[model samples]
Target: MKILALESSAVSASVALTEDEKLVAQSFQNCGLTHSRTLLPMAENLLANCGVSLADVDAIAVAHGPGSFTGVRIGVATVKGLALGADKPCLGVSTLEAMAWGARALGGDLCCVMDARAGQVYNALFTVEDGRVRRLCDDRAIKLTELAEEIGEAPYFLVGDGADLCYNTIKENCTGLRLAPAELRFATGFGVAAAALPLFREGKACSPQELDAFYLRRPQAERERMARLAQTK
Candidate 1:
């Protein structure tokens, strides 16, 4: 299957094209530009360079949620438009899962995390065995201390944009934790494609309208608003 995937769930954004399990073309940028400006252009450039358009792609995939709320919204919205326009299937892979898929080559425990701020991270656990990723936990927003306790010294590679923060916060407590290399630390378009292909084969793809963001918690503004309301009440 030809899959076109987009990733903008964190600081960096990337677009990738994959044929079956092989990544054919990818354009990545971590230059601090707004995803709205960089994402579509990158996808267009990647497809154009690959000599394939949306019509040629069998599925449109995105890393949805558990990172920047605006970033996840942009990615999911982009995929929805492209898939709807091309009449292609839509794959909404978890941002954490996509990171895990990208690091499948590490072949051990994977602790995917994204900085969710306020001493918390968006995280999920996965184990890669024989080149396939098996999810160990549902995606969640968790405190660093709780996460460290749950991990309990088992050897694991930290992944995603928050790897460094997570590692530093709990490193003393979790002796077996190691930071993944720089290249494997962030979510990428290729990772989204890698995570989506299996779901596509399992008949789990959705329509454009059904594809949606998966933020683990409400945005900070919303939380603050609720807090204010509670104080007034």
Candidate 2:
């Protein structure tokens, strides 16, 4: 199956093409540019350079959420637009799960995290065995102390934008933690494709309208609004 995947859940944005479980081509950028400006262009360039077009793709996939609200929306909207235009199915994989796929080479307890700010992170636990990622928990927003307690002494390789922050904050208490190298640390388009492949095989792909963001927590704007209402009460 041919998959075109997109990732813009964090500061970086990337597009990847994969076929039969192998990466064909990928374009990645982390220049602090807005994803709305860079993502689609990157996808177009990646496909043109690789001689593959939207019609040739079997399914469009993206890391749907639990990261930047705007980034997640951009990624999901981009994939939805592509899938709708091509009349193709969509695979919306978890942002944390996509990062797990990226760290599969490490092969052990995988702690996927993204900086969710305010002493918390968007996290999910997974264990990779024989090149397959198995989720141990649902995606969640968790405090570092609680996450560390959950990981207690079971060696975990941290992967995601929050790895450095998590490693430093919890390392003194959680001795079994190690950070993934910079390249494999963050979410990627290739990882999104890799995560989507299993779902595709399992017949989990959905229509363009079915694809949706997966933010673990409410958006900041909504939270602020609620706080203001509470104050008024």
Candidate 3:
């Protein structure tokens, strides 16, 4: 099976193509360019370079949420259009899950954290054993102190944009924490493709109309608006 995946849930944006479990091609950029200006073009170039067409892909996978709200929307919308145009199924992979999967080779407990600001992070925990990832916690926005307390002393390798923040905050209390190397620290298109494979095999891929972003919390702008309403009331 062939899968084309997009990852733009953070500052970095990447496109990747995979056949079965092997990567065929990938393009990544992190020069502060907006995903709107880079993601689709990157995908086009990657497919062209690989001598493949979007029509050849069985499914389109995308990092659905828990990162930059705009970035998540861009990825999901792009895949929605591609899936509709090519008449293929779409798999919405979780951003935190993809990050965890990126560190699967490390083989131990994984704590995925993405900067959500306001002294909190979008976080999740997973256990990777024998190249397989199992979720130990659901994705949610949480305070660093709460995260540190919940994790306790279970030696975990952290991976994500917020890894440094998590590591620094809990390092004193949790000496078993380790930061993932730069390459595996953030969401990647290849990781998205890998995470989508199991979903595709389980027949969980859906039509373009059913695809949607999985934002664990409301966007900041929405939160601010609601706060104003509460103040007035």
Candidate 4:
């Protein structure tokens, strides 16, 4: 199956084209917070290099997130537009799931923690045994302290940009943890998109309207508003 995949759930913006589980081409830009500006253009370039157009793709896959709200929306909205125009099915892969794929070579309990900000992270636990991911903990927001307390006594390899951000805290908290190598620190468009394409072939897709980001916490703006209301009282 020919699939077009998008990754804009973080600071990086990337696009990938895959054919029959093999990578054909990818375009990635991680210069700064420019996913909104560069995503479509990157997609265009990747497609052009692969000599394929949106209509030629059998399905569109996206990282439906527990990520940057703006980043996730940009990716999902872009894919929704392309899918609608091309008349193709769409797949929503979890952002954390993609992280697992990037670290499939790590060979142990995989902990994915993306920065949810305000002293918290969106974390999930998975064990990769026999070449497949088995979820040990559901994805949700937790304070770094809470994560450390809850993270069990097992050798874990952490992935995601957020992991890097909280390195000191992790070392202090998640005791006896084994960190994954730098190469597997973050998700790649090729890795994530390829990992999610099977569902597209199996007719496991959601309506565009039903596609949603897995935000583990309320938006920061909402929290600020609630704080102000509490102060007023």
Candidate 5:
């Protein structure tokens, strides 16, 4: 089975191709360009460089959410368009899960955190065993203090854009925490492909019509609008 995956749930945008469990090709960019301008083009370039066409891919996968709200939408929209055009199945992998999967080679527990700002993070916990990741917690928007308290002093590799933020907050309380290397810390198309494989196997892949983003919280604009309505009421 061939899978083409896109990851744009953060500042970085990446595209990857995987055949079964093996990654065939990948392109990642964090050059400060907007994902709307880089994502589809990067995927096109990757496929061309690999001498493969969209028609050759069996499924399309993307990091679905819990990162930048705009970035998540761009990724999901792009995947939906690709899947619709190719008439292939689409898989939505969690951005947090992909971060943990990206660091699976480290072979330890993972604390995946994405900077959700305002002293909070999009967080999840996972354990890697025998090269596979098992989730220990559901995705959530949580305060750094609460996260630090929950993780305790257990040794874990922190992975994601918010790795440093989490490390600094929990370091005093959690002595065994380690920050993942720069390469493994952020979301990647390869990670998305790897994380989506199990979901595909479990028949979780869906049509483009079913593709959607998984924002853990409301966007600031929506919150502001609601606040104004509450004030008027």
Candidate 6:
């Protein structure tokens, strides 16, 4: 199976082609928040590097949400357009799940957290058992320590952008917990391909309209509008 995956939910923008359970081409950028300029180029460039075209790809996979609202839209919209243009199947994978997949060695509970700004983080708990990633909690925005308290007894491994930021706090709050190292940070291209492979086999894909970003919180503009309407009332 050949899957083209795009990940731009964070500051880093990455594109990859996974074929036959191997990564053929992958490009990642952490230079700045220049996803708008870099994402498509990286995608196009990755395809070029591998001598693969959109027509040759079996599916387009993307990290869907809970990060930069604009970044999420860019990735989702890009794949949606590609899928529609080529009449291909589309898969929207969760950013949190991807993060947890990066930390599959947790051996117990897995906690994935992404910086949500405003002194909060988008967080969730997962259990990596027998090679299956299972969500133990739904995604949410909460203070770092609160997350620690919430997952009380389980020995967990923390992964994500917010993990570094909350490392000490989480460690101080919970015993028997491990934080993933920076070197083990990325959700690999092969990992994503593995996650999407079953979906590909099951024909669980979507159209452009079905492709959507998963923003756990409302967009800033929507929140601003709601605040303004409330003030008027």
Clash number by candidate, in order = 0, 0, 0, 0, 0, 0
Q: Which ten residues in a row have the lowest lDDT in candidate 5?
A: 161-170
lDDT of each: 0.94, 0.94, 0.92, 0.79, 0.93, 0.80
Q: Which segments of model 5 are wrong by more than 4 Å?
A: none
Worst 10 residues of 1 by lDDT: 45-54
Quote the lDDT for 153 in model 5.
Answer: 86
Summarize candidate 2's per-residue lDDT along 63-108 as a digit string, tens digits. Answer: 9998999999999999999999999999999999999998899998
RMSD to true structure for each model, in Å: 0.7, 0.7, 0.8, 1.8, 0.8, 1.9
Off by over 4 Å in 6: 187-191
After superposing candidate 3 on the true structure, give the runs of residues whose Cα lies further than 4 Å from its correct spot. Answer: none
Tens digits of per-residue lDDT, candidate 6, 1-233, equal 79998888887787889886667877878888578898888888889988889999989998887888988999888888888899998988888887776567655778888888777889888898887688888888898767777877568787877777767666766776777877556554445565676677888878777988998999878999999999999
Candidate number that wins on lDDT, 3 or 6: 3
Selected candidate, larger TM-score, 1 vs 5: 1
Query: Against the true structure, candidate 4 has what lDDT?
Result: 0.79
- Model 5 residue 76 CA deviation (Å) reads 0.6
Q: What is the lDDT of residue 151 in candidate 3?
A: 81
lDDT of 5 by residue, 1-233 (tens): 99999999998999999999999999999899999999999999999999999899989999999889999999999999989988999999999999888889988899999999899999999999999999999999999999888888899999999999889887999898999889999899999999999999999999999999999989999999999999999
